[model samples]
Target: MMKKRTILRFFILATLLLCSSSAWAQGHSYLKTAAGKSLQAELEFHRDPHQTFAVRGDNLVLAGDLPVNVNYDFDYSVLEGQTLTVDGEQQHGGRNLVSIVTSPGEVRVESGTMTINKVTKEGEKAFLEGTYELTLEEGKTLSGEFKLHTQFRDYNLSSLGWVFMLASIAGVWLLAIFCYKKLLFDAE
Candidate 1:
């Protein structure tokens, strides 16, 4: 009885831990100082699960595996300030990911920004939730949260995705065994 309960608890915990993994999102801060000097920075941001994620005081190297037509540049290299202040609290989160095409492809963005309003915390990790304002190079802008069943053509299979998939299978298997025992053998 106790053993079965322990196993059940383990399965539940594992599911939660695996499914709530974080996704990385970033942007840029283009600003002009009080003296009208221009400066720029590529911002790699992480909200919850870590309000203290470090933004280095040194030179930041910004690079990505983004599409060809899409590219990032800082108007002027070297962030003017040694530090940047970031503070925002969002109470809602959890991303609903779906398959855009099933076989996997790519998501292309021309321009604009992606703002994650709320970040979900699962165990020691975090999950994605927010809206993207994308402007393709041809003078078009798209604004919306990534909706359910909307798959990225080239979806990056993150570790969190694997963990969540495996954990779900394990949870289902465990639950079936547990139910079978409770019904047939009366293990309670």
Candidate 2:
């Protein structure tokens, strides 16, 4: 019975860990435009995960929806210097779609860790510093290398829910103890 209960407790804990909403969170992306413009988009809307702007790979699909409602999807690659096909359409001809130059290292953005890559200057390549505060074209200031995001990557758990979960565990343990005593020792 002890072994059974230990297994049961493990299962219950696993279930709670898996089904919890705080495990996953909404991510956001911050970008600076060529015109020195500042743009922010939600990962939920931009279709990125863990606030990952984009991964460097072949035929990578990248989209930046900003300025309200102008949806643009493009196929791009970071490892290879290829023309970024805008709108994912072959006919448009990706000549000057978007360019980026990233340094070799990891940068902390907001509460989560994000890759601080440069949104390359037209006709020229530029380097991005991870510890610098960036100002946008619209006069919006990004706080340190974190110009990309402004939040931490911690669990979004509610204090009330956490308390309730703890209480439930204690209650279950107490009930189990009472049941064990009544059945094993109090059986007269």
Candidate 3:
């Protein structure tokens, strides 16, 4: 009877530990860049899970994959004296290229073109397309992009989920051990 009680106690503790650990081990975000043409570029702001910013001559492209709504703003000093264009429309801004787009879309500028697209279950990528012509200037230009992506899964338990799991398992285990000891060992 005593042996049975001890085994029940061990079972309860192990169950609680397992539940807590498994719950805490979920959900993470990361960034990834792919194989592509190298262009002179700088990142002024990064506000998403994965992002890329590139500049070719007078054209610029910014892309990313994200799980939530994020806003990023950037300035380009490289396009000092060039005219800006997007989707074939001329932009009057002194800086060559300025653009904004949601993820899985496109932002085309005089310096280049940028396309944001979904990459995987948990990732995304951006692409550059079109031509660029550079002039001369000093003050610089600004461009930005925004994205929102949300994913949900059942097994992807959050911190609260783990806590609940642990509490339930511990409670069950304690009750089982108490019952076994009272009815079997203490009764004997």
Candidate number achieving the greatest lDDT relative to the actual structure: 3
lDDT of each: 0.34, 0.34, 0.36
Candidate 1 structure quality by residue, lDDT tens digits, 1-188: 99999999999998876665311221223222234432233233322232222211122111111111111121111221212222121211122121111111233233343343443333422333444444433464334442111111223566999899999999999999999989999955
Better of 2 and 3 by TM-score: 2
For candidate 2, give the lDDT: 0.34
The alpha-carbon lDDT assigned to residue 145 of candidate 3 equals 31
* Model 1 / residue 41 / CA error / Å: 24
Query: After best superposition, candidate 2 residue 133: deviation in angstroms?
Result: 12
Name the 10 consecutive residues with the lowest summed lDDT in model 2: 83-92
Query: Pairs clashing in candidate 1?
Result: 22-126, 100-151, 105-153, 105-154, 106-153, 106-154, 110-136, 111-135
Number of the candidate with higher TM-score, 1 or 3: 1
Question: Model 2 TM-score?
Answer: 0.25
For candidate 3, write residues 1-188 as lDDT tens digits: 99999999999999998987644321111112232222233222232233222222222333222223323222222222322223322222223234432123333332323333322233322221223332112322323331212222134576999999999999999999999999998995
**Candidate 2 Cα outliers beyond 4 Å, as residue runs:** 1-29, 36-147, 153-162, 186-188
Candidate 3 local distance difference test against the native: 0.36
